[model samples]
Target: MEVNIRHARAGVTIAVDGLAELRELEWHDGHVRIGAGLNLTEIERRLDGRIPLMAEWFPQFASRLIRNSATLGGNIGTASPIGDSPPTLLALDASLILASREGEREVALADFFRGYRQTELRDGELIRAVKIPLPLAPITGFYKYAKRRFDDISSVAVGIALELESDNVRRIRIGLGGVAATPIRALKAEEALAGKPWTKRNVREAARVMGQEGTPLSDHRASADYRAAMLEQALLKFFFEKSEVVRG
Candidate 1:
C-alpha cells in the first residue's frame, strides 16, 4: 500500500490507499475481478487455485519485499515492455476496467499498450480492475529469461494459454514481452498452432513463426538474436514441460 515518490520536483504526493473502491477484489461465478490497489502477494494468495497460471509464474517475480509493496495497477500503469505480468494477462485475454468521473470503460489487455510505456488510458482515467474469463481445464505456462533468476527484469518473457480438444489445439494464445516496443500477442504464432495436432513438430514450426512475430532490439540484457532465440525456445520449452497435460 506504499507508493514511491518518483518526481524530485514534486510539491505534494497524496496517498490514495484509503480509496475503498480501488481496494476491492471480487470473485464471480465465471470470472474474477482484481482491484488495482491490491499488491502482487495479495493477488497471488487470493487467486492461487482459481488462477493457477499466476502461481506458476509468481515465484519468478521480484522478491517478497517488493511484491508486498508493488501493486498490479502500478505495474500496468507503467506499461513497460518487459513487465512480467502484462504478457500473462494478455494471454489470458484479460480486460481492464478504467474509471473516471465520466464513466467506466473496458479495454482488452491485448489492445491496452500503444507504445513503450504508453497505453490507451486517457486523462482523468485510472485503472479500476482487471477481469479475466474463466477457462475450463486450461493449460498455461509462463517463462522469463533474465540476468538473474529473481528480482531482475526479463530479457525475454513468454506466456502461453492452451485449451486442448483430444490432442488438438482447440484454442491457443501466445504473449511475448521485451522483444518489441510493447508487450504483444503473437497472433501469427497462435494462428500457426491453432487446430493443429499437439506434437513436437507442430510446436517447433509454430515457434519458428513466433520468432518472427516481434522486432527485437539489442540491449544490455541480451542481443536481438539471443532474445529471438529465447522466444522460440520458450515456446518449445513450455510445450514440452506441459506435454502430458497438453496430450490429455
Candidate 2:
C-alpha cells in the first residue's frame, strides 16, 4: 500500500493462494496438465525426460533465483512476445485451460495471445492448467539469441517440431518469438518444408520463408535485420542438428 501510494498508483493486489486447481501438476493419459502456480524449478524437474523440449527450454529461463519464484502460469499470463516458453509451447501444440465461476474452457496456446500482453482471458477468470500433448515430434529443437546467454531476454527465438518419414518432411511446426506482436507459428515456412525432402536446399528455402513470417523491430538488444537473419539461421541449425541425429 505504501509503495503504490508513493508511486501514485492503485495499491490493490489480490492473493490467489487458495486456488487449489491452479497448483496441479499431473499426467493425464499421455499428456501432462501443469498448473499455472507451479514454479519453474518444479516444472523443469518434473518435465525432464517426460517432455524433452520443455526440459531443454526451461533451463534457459532467467536465473535460478527467479525460477524458484516464477510461475509457469505467470509467464503465460504476462504474454511477452519474447517469453521463452511460448515459442516452445506453440511448437508442441499445447493448450491452456481457463477457469471461472461459470465453468472451464480450453484455448489453443497459439491462439491464446490477442496482442501485446493481451490474451483471450476474460474478466473473473484465471488460468487453470496447461495441457502438453504427449509423444512430441521425433525432431524437436529450440534456439534463442540474447546479449547474455543466461539471465537476459532473447532478441530472437525459434522452436522447431518436425516429424519425418524416411528422408521427407512428414509434418513440421515452427514457432517464433521476439519477431512479432505475439509468438507465432511460421506456417508459411512449415508449408514450404512439409512433404519435401529434408535437404539443405529445402531447409534453406524454408528458412528464407521463416524470416518473413513476423514483423520484427529494432531494439536495444538487436537490430531488425540481425533478428531476421537469426531467425533463418536458427531454423537451419535445427535442421542440421536433426540430420546429425539421423546419421548417428
Candidate 3:
C-alpha cells in the first residue's frame, strides 16, 4: 500500500511468503519463537491463550482483513510509533531475531526502535522471528483508546504486565504507543510502583508518572492532554478491573 500510494519507493520488491524457514514457530529455551512471516490471525490461532496479553490484543488490532495479511515482521519493520504490536510485545519483554548473510542476532524490542520510523536493522538484516520469554505475568491488560471502538487507529495504547506479591507490586512493565517518537516502556512509573502496596494512592502516584512518561504531541486523532489523560486512566482502570476480579 505504501508503494501504491507513493509513500514508499522501491526499485524492486521481493516476496518472502514462500520462505518456509521464516514461518516456523516453536518453543525453545524457555521462550516462544514466533516466525516473522506469520500473520496476526495465524499468530492468534497458534498461540491460543497461552500469552494472555497478546490474546487480548489481537482482536483490537485493526480489522480481520488487515490481521489476515499483516505480518509481525512487517509491523515491527515499519517502526511506526502508533503500531499496536510494539507496545504489547514490549510489555511481554519480547525481542527480535535479526538475520543476515553473516549470522543472526537478537535485539530487545525496547532497543529496536531508534527514532520515529527508524530501527536498528542493518542494510542486509531482516527480522526472522520474535522471541517472547516464558512464564507470563499474572496480571496483564491491553488498552487502546481511539475515536471509534472498532476498526480505528489508536490515539493512546497501553500494554501492561504485572506481578503482585501479598498485595504489593512485585514487578510491573508498562508499554505505551502514540505518545512518543517510538514505543517506550514507562520506566519511571514502574519504579514508582515496584515493591509498593497495590493501593489507590500508590497506583495514583504511578499513574501520574506514566502520564508524563512519553513526549506526546497533539494530532488529529486526539489532543496531547487527552492522550496523557488516557495513559493515567488506563493504569487505574487495569487496577480496578483486577481488584474486582479478586473480589469476585
Predicted structure with the largest lDDT when compared to the true one: 3
Evaluated at residue 80, the lDDT of candidate 1 is 89
- Candidate 3 residue spans exceeding 4 A from truth: 4-7, 245-248
| Residue-level error in angstroms, candidate 3, position 134 | 0.9
TM-score to true structure, per model:
0.94, 0.93, 0.96
lDDT of 1 by residue, 1-248 (tens): 12455534546766664477877888888778898888888888887767877787788888999898787788888898999988888888888999999999999999999998899999989999888887533899989999997998899888888888878899998888899999999999999988989899999999999988889999889999999999899999988899787556
Residues 38-85 of candidate 2: C-alpha lDDT, one tens digit per residue: 888887877676777777787788899999888878888888999888
Considering TM-score, where higher is better, how would the candidates rank from best to worst? 3, 1, 2
Worst 10 residues of 1 by lDDT: 1-10
Error of 2 at 77 (Å): 0.8
In candidate 3, which residue pairs clash? none
Instruction: Give stretches of model 2 more than 4 Å off.
Output: 1-10
